[model samples]
Target: ADHRVSLPLAALLGAAFLPLADVAARVIDRPAETPVGILVAAAGSPFFILLARRIGRR
Candidate 1:
């Protein structure tokens, strides 16, 4: 397995998620901010599971 593949994937996921977190923090709260890790995990877990399942199938 190319373990190095995960590094770029992780970076890309963070890059994609920060803006979403920032937007949610700005629009969904007036004086508070949501943690980006929560948003990332909420979205990433399902995706990671699906990807793992597909890879396992192969």
Candidate 2:
């Protein structure tokens, strides 16, 4: 994949994902709030692991 395309796609996906994660943090705890970082890390860790593995293989 081209970096030109991949970078913009990643940026767009991040732009879309952040608000959804923020909403989830608010709703998940109901009367309270969960930290947005927790949700982001939970959602992102798998992808980061996968990327790390892919890079390691190269």
Candidate 3:
């Protein structure tokens, strides 16, 4: 197991899932609103960084 490749790949997979979980929460017709943690994690994850960095992060 190569930490160099695997760790980043794991981080990326976790971060990618963060946003889907958020959307699922909001779309599931739950009584309560989505949790703050989910929203924060979705926005703050490296998935967002990966997206923005591709757009130059301006």
Candidate 4:
């Protein structure tokens, strides 16, 4: 019934999975495309920052 509790848990899960996913992708090393680690993070930084600021404002 508590949205706040679930939100934090989901965020924590996402934070944990992001790094793990990147690490696994790099290790896999596909022949077609080199595994890219942290590409999502790199691309998402700006959007994440903007989101954080907006959330902080509220």
Q: What is the lDDT of candidate 2?
A: 0.97
- Winner by TM-score between candidate 2 and candidate 1: 2
Pairs that collide in candidate 1 are none
Candidate 3 TM-score, C-alpha based: 0.50
| Order by TM-score, highest first | 2, 1, 3, 4
The sequence of per-residue lDDT tens digits that candidate 2 reaches over residues 1-58 is: 8999999999999999999999999999999999999999999999999999999999
Clashes of 3: 0
Q: What is the Å distance of residue 57 in model 2 from its true position? A: 1.7
Q: Where does candidate 2 stray beyond 4 Å? A: none
Candidate 1, residues 8-57: lDDT per residue as tens digits? 89789878878977787666666887776677687779999999999999
Candidate 4 colliding pairs:
none
Model 4 per-residue lDDT tens digits across residues 1-58: 5989999997998798787777766666665434454566665789899989999999
Worst 10 residues of 2 by lDDT: 35-44
lDDT of 1: 0.80
Select the stronger candidate by TM-score from 1 and 4.
1
Q: How well does each candidate superpose onto the true structure, as a TM-score?
A: 0.58, 0.89, 0.50, 0.49
Worst 10 residues of 3 by lDDT: 35-44
Lowest summed lDDT across 10 adjacent residues in model 4 is found at 29-38
Model 2 steric clash total: 0
Instruction: List all candidate RMSDs to the true structure.
Output: 3.1, 1.0, 7.6, 5.3
Q: Model 3: per-residue lDDT, tens digit, 12-42?
A: 9878877777777776667876774766676
Candidate with maximal lDDT: 2
